[model samples]
Target: MMFKTDKQTLTDLNVLDWNSASLLRFFDHTLTLGGRDQLYNYLMHPLTTIEEIVERQETIAYLSTVNVSKLFDKYMMVDLERYLNKPAAPSVKNRTSYFLDTISFNFFSLSAQREQLLVRQSVREIAMLFTALQDIVAEAKSSGKAVGLLRIYADFFSANASVFDKEEMRQVGRGKSWRLTTHKYNYLFRGKRRPQVQELFNMIYTLDALTAVAKMWNEGGLCFPRVNTNDTAAALLRIEGLYNLALDNPVKNDIHIPSAQNIWFLTGANMTGKSTLLKSIGICIHLAHVGFPVPAQSMETILFKGLMTSINLLDNIGSGYSHFYAEVMRLKTMGEIMTVDNPVVIMLDEIFKGTNYQDAYEATLNFINSISGIESSLFFVSTHITDLGEIVGMDSCVALKHLETKADPKQGAIFTYKLLDGIATEKLGMWFLNRESVFETFRAVQPRKSSS
Candidate 1:
């Protein structure tokens, strides 16, 4: 089955966005278009089985250190599929045709030149990719490392290495003058070679994607999360020293949720880094599932079937849905998913804020009670409802955590962004209002003396 997640979940996790600071962009160091597409595909559909996840993690771990040379220059690989898949162009066949073409080929020269350039690039990239794969295989064998995925790739290249080593193809691919030879040109441009060309691009992209992932792994000091897949009746999700990858200087937090605990109710004053913490956990879960290294000192979790989020929600003005109704709809959606037997991780920030205090509290409380009993699900919900925490904390399935704030009469509120046990009672909204002199501004307004 496809990895179960929606657009809103992706948005809430900040996973994919081209023009913004997204998780995908954060790790996107692809060297070619094919590699980028491959990366996107993997990110979109995370692995479900522990074996698959382990296989990928093993691949990434091994490749991260392998000093594979740069396969091609920056953005050197273009959209060559269209050119390669097209029918082979008519060429100057023999000496007689060559002479005729020299005098009268001007009409088709421009198009042919473009086509020739594309073909030459295709040949060069294919050759380079072949050589790189060969080297990778040799290294793996020589090192005597048990690399599952890399060995598969190496074997694949070994089977196809002859395609790149043919005397005619090799000379032409290397840009020797033999590329202009009619026979060699025809052989390289044969329509039959389209599949090979496509495969070569894919292999190159695979390398690029691996390299890019390795770059992130090294730069972020990331670690592979230990995935739990035993059929036992226990659930566990824990991370040590976790931090947000997008932050310049991120505060690290530890999360420990035993099998009995499902709900993590976070309470903190505004701007206490509650949302950032939620995002950090969400991102860690996502990257873990994708088999990519996560920005944490260490992490371990039971393999969840999917992920759901209700953060950064917005009302639909065009649909006539109020913010409260929109939030209700989101919860309802999660409620439907809860029926599935598969385990899932759910996050809700500032739950039920769209409605009044009483209604929001009741709704959030009821929702928490209902989902807390679900042993197959995990939750991280943040809210300003400190009163509800006392009641919710009583449930064995729920854990109450908060971000503490230090307030000084002169300094206003100083946020430590540290996660701690128990609910927070700091209502610093008034403090900020007072610090801003909101009431003083009204008092300072001059009585309309001039108008009077």
Candidate 2:
């Protein structure tokens, strides 16, 4: 089974985008276009099984210790890929046909001659790429790190070793005896061994993607998460020192949501890092499913069937829906998912914020009450209405938590940005208004007695 996610969840977490600041851009250090595409595919489809996820994690962990990037050149790989994908030309039957074809190309057709030259360049590129892979395999074996995906690649290269003979490739690359050996080798490569060559390039591209992920792991100081495929009733998510990667200096927070307390009713004031914390959790969950290292010191989680996040949701103007309606629809979708998929992670930031205060409070309270019965799924609901916390706090399944904020005489409100136990009682809305001088500015302007 594939891990379940949607565009809204992906957009909420900034998972895949062309923007430089996106998570995809942050981890994409692949050397070739095909490699980048492979990386994108990895991000798009996260694994559902713990075994598959662990295997990928081990492969990347091994890659992080080695310098495989030094063996590949982006341009050369790109050229080789283009050459392999090109349509193969008719092969000459014998030496007589080869000689005549060469004569015809050289004398009559400039385009044919140019094509032959390009083919020779492509042959050299392929040979160089194969040699690089050979070295990589040798390095992996000598280091005793050739296992999992690396071992598979090594085995493939070993099985096809005769085809990519170093001496023959070297001679063919040097254009030695073009009339005889070049045509024979070209026929062997482009005609007879095309499928194998394509398979080799696919492996190279996969390596490039994994190498990029490994680089991210090493550079970001990320840790591989321990994923368990237990019953949904035993779902658990615990992470220590977890923070958002986009921030230069993010405040790390510890989160622990055991199966008993499946829902966390979060309360915090505005700008108290609630949204950032939610995004960080969602990002880590998604990365864990991808078998990629998460931006955390350590983590242990059960394999979740699905993930959904409702943050920064917009109104569907074309569909004649207001923001509140959109929020309701999103919640409906999440509810539908929860019905079939147990152990799904659902995150809602400031639920029903687009509605009136009374309606928001009632809706939030009722929603929490409704979802608290679903003990298998995990829910993180952050809201400004701390009153609901007092009600939901009594529930055995609801964990009441908040981002701590302290009041300062000089600074007005100093946000600690720390996750703390208990409901938040602080209300700093008026303080924010005064600190920004919003009322004072209005008083000073006074609308200039517009009646005159």
Candidate 3:
């Protein structure tokens, strides 16, 4: 099964983008371009099955315990990749053919000699890379850590045993007999064993990507989430100490969403961390689906078919849709998605904020009531309209939650950035306005009279 998610959801969670603080950027420590591309592919298409996710998690966990830094270098890998991708030259038949070609290339054709030189350099790099991988495999086997993905890689080396022979590679490294040996190995690698060489390159790139993720796991102290496979019971997502990875020092919050109480009616004062909380939850869910370690102490969740978020939704000016209309369309999209039987996670940060208070309140209230009946999915709808809390509070399926904030005489509104039960009653919009002296600024700036 493929995991479902749209561009808007990814953008809302900052999962992948050109931004420096994107989740992809945070985990992208790859050395080679191939490794980076593989990492990008992994983030773009998250795994759906529990078995696949667990296997990837195990691979990353195993990698975290090993030293992969010595196996690859950026420049050497780049050169080897380039050389392998280039078209192979015509094969030399025998010693006579190689001798003639070498004489002709050296004396008559500068380009041919340069090409041969480049081929020799590429061969040398490949030999070095094979030697490095062989050493790593030897160490892993000696230490009895060659299992799982490592074992698979080791088996590949074994299958191509002649290609990574210790004495032969050492000979290739020393440049003992350049003309015959270089052309021979080059033909063997780039011509006869092209497919195997390509496969080896792919494996190394994948290992590089996984090793980067493992490094992130070690540095960030991230943990692999427990994917609950019990389908007999209701779906649940329980995350403890969840925080946004984009923030340097983010305040952690715990979240619980059971199928029994699927809808979370979130309310809070402006800028009190409601949107941040929603983004953090969305990011964790996304990372968990990708089989990457999440920025949380612990997490347990049933597999979800999709995850959608409308945190920073924008209006379609070119399409002639107002902000309110766009918001309605987004919700309509979510409603259609919820029609499916599979479970999903939907997050709407400050829904209906583009419209007037009365319309927003009525729409939010009705929407909450409608989605609350969706027991298959989880809903997190945040709103500035605290009045709807009273009506939604009555629904047993809706969990009333808010980011806690306190008012201080000296400090004004003190944002705790903490998630707590119950709705926020304080209206701090006017307090913020007064604090910023907006009214005073307006009064101070009088309209200029036209000179007649």
The candidate with the higher lDDT, 1 or 2, is: 2
Tens digits of per-residue lDDT for model 1, 79-170: 45565556664464554554354346454688867755665666555555555566676788679764757777667766765555555444
> Please, what are the lDDT tens digits per residue for candidate 2 over residues 1-452?
66779999999999898887688999999988888989999999999888788878988988888777754678877777777767764676754565466556545487887777777787766666677677787788888888768787888888988776777776665556454566665666677688887887888888889999998888866999998766642348989999988888889999888788989989999999999999999999999999999999999898889999999899998999999999999999988887778779999999999999999999998998888778667899999998887788899999999999988777778888899999998998998898789988888874655684
User: For model 1, what is the error of residue 278's alpha carbon versus the real structure, in angstroms, after optimal superposition?
Assistant: 0.5
Model 2 Cα shift for residue 181 (angstroms): 3.2
- How do the candidates rank by lDDT, highest first? 2, 3, 1
lDDT of each: 0.77, 0.84, 0.83
**Model 2, residue 229: C-alpha shift (Å):** 1.8
Tens-place lDDT per residue, model 3, 60-91, is 98888878776567887777878887876457
Which segments of model 2 are wrong by more than 4 Å?
91-103, 107-109, 158-167, 170-179, 231-235, 446-452
Greater TM-score among 1 and 2 belongs to 2
Higher-scoring candidate on lDDT, 2 or 3: 2
Q: What TM-score quantifies how close candidate 3 is to the native fold?
A: 0.90
